[model samples]
Target chain A: MPFHPACHSYEPVTIADRLFLDLRRAILEGELPAGKKISEPELASIYGVSRGSLREAISKLENCNLVTRRPNIGARIVNFSIDQLMEIYQIREAMEGMAARLAAKNMTEAELAHLKSLVARHKDSLLHTERPAKTDYSQDADVDFHFCIIQGSKNQRLLTMLCQDLYDLVRFYRMRLSPAFSSTAMQEHELIVQALERRDGEMAELLMRYHVRASRDRAKQRLESMSPEELGSHH
Target chain B: MPFHPACHSYEPVTIADRLFLDLRRAILEGELPAGKKISEPELASIYGVSRGSLREAISKLENCNLVTRRPNIGARIVNFSIDQLMEIYQIREAMEGMAARLAAKNMTEAELAHLKSLVARHKDSLLHTERPAKTDYSQDADVDFHFCIIQGSKNQRLLTMLCQDLYDLVRFYRMRLSPAFSSTAMQEHELIVQALERRDGEMAELLMRYHVRASRDRAKQRLESMSPEELGSHH
Candidate 1:
């Protein structure tokens, strides 16, 4: 999940907020499937919410670019095209690179140690397994590592744009490409953490940018290999 | 205006949409100074719209991050701090850099020529001026040059994110800082155009990135030069 630490509340969110969060996660994770039409009444029934609340929630989703709504045709999950996917990678490389640089300067000693531990844990899992490829470097762990650096940047605008505006659009590509980069990815992650540990902003930013660009290139290759129809529901 | 040709209307938008657009522009341009409170009834009467429509418009602005809404206090225009201003620059460098790289590959011959002409026009303005330092380097012209390259990227995601999601947040800082970089900025712009003409993606990306980063550093220095109170309403 894309973390928003500030969104935590002492008072609970409304029924509409809950519905929006659930619907957003489902759509972003592709469980709801891209390009699937939403019948408002049907979804209202499914979520056990009033149609009005669901409509409000859906409007928010549309604002977030998670949904595309037409007057008569209704709403569908957005499918990004391969070109758009590569564009996202380019932007990510820039933003995440800055995040790494800031994190190098801003992260506490404890956070650096935590990052190192996470990388070590992943490497340990790989070594102990007979088939390292089957060990499945967990996506959650990877996201956690990145999220920590992102949050550590302490730049609210950067954090919001990356986590809220851009993260979901890439979930599909990430799911498809994440597991494929294992051993090399581990070395990249560890080196990035080491740069932060040294508080070397330049190296940290360079490594992070390189990592994101590499991933983007790999994603480009994968998408080029696919037919447009198969990448469907890609907006 | 940050053009979104797709956001153009086949059918005219509702009253709420009109109000939202007007209010968003006013807030972003600093016409309605940041941290100024919004009174629903006051704005409703000012806009000659119903309270319901005004409220809807305010909610949309809140979603756009041009305004902040609190339960008891109502809404106020967003005021970004110097740190937040620098944060936005870091992002623009990353996104705009990639846009330049993509534009090198994607821009039509005609588009490249047009970009070159725009740069030539700016240079001519500098040479003919009585006081080159006081010559008005039109922000509109500057925006047009950048906007063309961004759109020429043909990466809809990058275009939308840069144009829609991020551009206006930096306007105040940009308007304040833009003049300082005029002559050299003209040189940088021309060099970038030359790279695009040569279809050199790497050089174009590098030059464009350096341009953005230089602007950012200048903006940062300006903000740092200001006293907290002088910066005013910086949140």
Candidate 2:
């Protein structure tokens, strides 16, 4: 029998698939630090892959906005300036606002319950840490909370755009976010969850938008406070 | 002197750049109809390009969701089902909604006046067309209207995502939009402009979101009314 590819199902993975994820993770975690010049030969050898495989990965990363390549010159990791990061936050406000609205109607009772618990846990942590700025919560946990709400939106396209397309860039931003940013974020999350429980989609969406904008302001202020000398591209 | 790549500016373009735009135009215009299998060799021959160049173009197209490649399975033009189209509308709602909000705040007096004339011209055409449904106004004008508002948002990242990344797909949807959809859209555009004139960002955003969602419903209802026997994959 002839093997016909399924209309909706994806085919098997290739080197480009794996390398794209690996390179993306490295960049997000600052392993391949921003503003660093990427030597294709070095990466190909380091990853134990061919130049062809590495180039493909580079192309995919470029598409994902994680890396940028110049003709004749070469590729470099994307360096987000303070302004660019704030622009990202503005986009996030719109995206997550819609996500919260959808989640209000789509989230299951059990999902709502888990979200409640997640916020409560964060609130407890906020209370316990006398100097909340000194206690660094797991970035993954923070990621999970936002991701959970996004998943609850049940919009596959939205999921792909947010959780997949913008994943690395958002991760990079959140990873560098100061611990002091958490308490307010936690409070906002609690209110968002409460609105979701009541199926108040409008309120939930508005609050989520406000939450993201507030976070952006905090991030911008923090970055601004850093003396120009210390806010180097590599760091 | 150290050769440093600019963080915000993109690097130079190559063959992939030209072909991606060419092929995208062909696809959105339905010259490369939806559900058509993409043969690299055929496309290469058609465009007088090498296989290597063609593949790069294909990769770019896939990234834009204009085409879908399934590893071992081949690539095909993205064939949107009604549900998928609705999903696209939801995403557009969020993005254009944010865009309208920002545009309301940022558009200069001259920009707002130009926008006024644009909608006025469309209204004139709409009134003149005999059946209106048969005349088919230029899709480029429609694109410019949205692109203008998106530009007014003045958010580079949002601009890239809307204009650069999701561009072709959005164009495809707009190109297929029935002319019957024009009258109401024109009227709504007028209202949105009025809101912008008043500098009511919130109302402008809401109207824009509603406009997009209303368009989606009309498209959905039209598609649904067609019989399953008419539901060819190509259609």
Candidate 3:
């Protein structure tokens, strides 16, 4: 139930760290745009940082799998592809399902109460909204819901893998693939929380995996229905 | 099954890439020693590379989670800990379980035959070995067995996450722990392959998870029985 800015726990202590974070946000929010080449000199001048710091930041980005640096072609913002997105969902289904299972056994009493409150808040938000699917509130709430469970799992490596490395791409895709919110997802969240509350790791894992796979299917259906121009403009 | 040197698939393309691979090998093989501070200038001279290339290699090491860098404190090879090794096992249980499930669904007939042959080769090696538990062949065979299934998953991101990122840490632990091979583990591998052969994704995942959990328990028992000096000397 702890929240960190940019959904990352690491604090920026150096110029390169700060630049990495800022650039990370830029890419996540679609400010830099997907599949776009990173112009070293241009970005350096724009951010008012030296090329050394920028390069360091770029390396950090590469670590997050946000940017791909080619041997000769330089770095580019990771292009959006349905296949890549589906692959991510497959990963999330596995990792987050394990996270939920662990959280059922490992989460503290206070953490369970916090998660309950979060789910309640999301439910409340859903009831008050006339257009819940279009609201960014739904997306943020869903992310918060997942993050709380991931943290509750109490596995540092799992936490780092999901939140620090994979979640960035999760956000990137969510931003570009807007309308990720659905009442069905909220209901799925409620069931997962219920399983967690019972301290049922098996049920928790099953429900979490089900939720993620359903979301993947929903997104795939949406993407398949969208025209090329619509898909291109969605970014 | 496709094999790569040093258990890593990436082919080095530049001075820094080659240096990164070399340093990565040193760290995994215990040549650099666990928990040792990385002296930049010393390593630069040792590797006959410039400070810039060495720094780049060190950064790459950080990405692999093989080195830890602190602000102003410099980088150090990641120290081995029982808790961390157990955590890695938990992660492998989830990711590799999913890989087995997907491989059951996705692997081609030829790939399946290759997997069967790999398992047979591992079984043959186990049968002939005087000390199957101590020989590095058992370890390599075990790694090859997992790598083949992981490749068969046909999920590029999953493959990269497991092979490129997590497997480095896995091999690091195996090298430091030594005697990671066991007939018990080979039997588990055989069961997993049988499930894969039948294309029972559900059973494959269940068996793989059981295998990983059993390995974790075996490792924990071994670690707990060792004295602090024994542990230190083992590294």
> Can you give the lDDT of residue A212 in candidate 2?
86
Give every collision pair in model 3: none
CAPRI grade of model 2? medium
Q: Tell me how many residue pairs clash in candidate 1.
A: 4
lDDT order, best first, reads 3, 2, 1
| Cα error, candidate 2, residue B61 (Å) | 0.6
Supply the global lDDT for candidate 2: 0.76
The models' CA-based lDDT, in order, is 0.76, 0.76, 0.84
Q: What lDDT tens digits, residue by residue, belong to model 3 across residues A118-164?
A: 88987887788776455447777788898899889988888888876
lDDT per residue for candidate 2 within B1-235, as digits (tens), equals 0011111223326776678778877888778878899988898998899988888788878877888887777899988777777777888899999999999999999888888898788777767877655546545556667877887788877887776556566667656655454577777888998999999999999999999888788878877886754544545
* Interface DockQ per candidate: 0.53, 0.62, 0.72
TM-score of chain B of 3: 0.91
- Candidate 1 lands at a TM-score of 0.86
User: Which residues of candidate 2, in runs, are more than 4 Å off?
Assistant: A1-13, A124-136, B1-13, B45-48, B133-135, B174-177, B228-235
Q: Which lDDT tens digits does candidate 1 get at residues B1-235? A: 5345643343425787778788877776668888888888998898899987787677667666777776455788877677777778777887788889989999998887887888778777777875636446556677778988988887777776776667766665564443554677778888899899889999998999899988777777777887776666666
State candidate 3's TM-score: 0.94
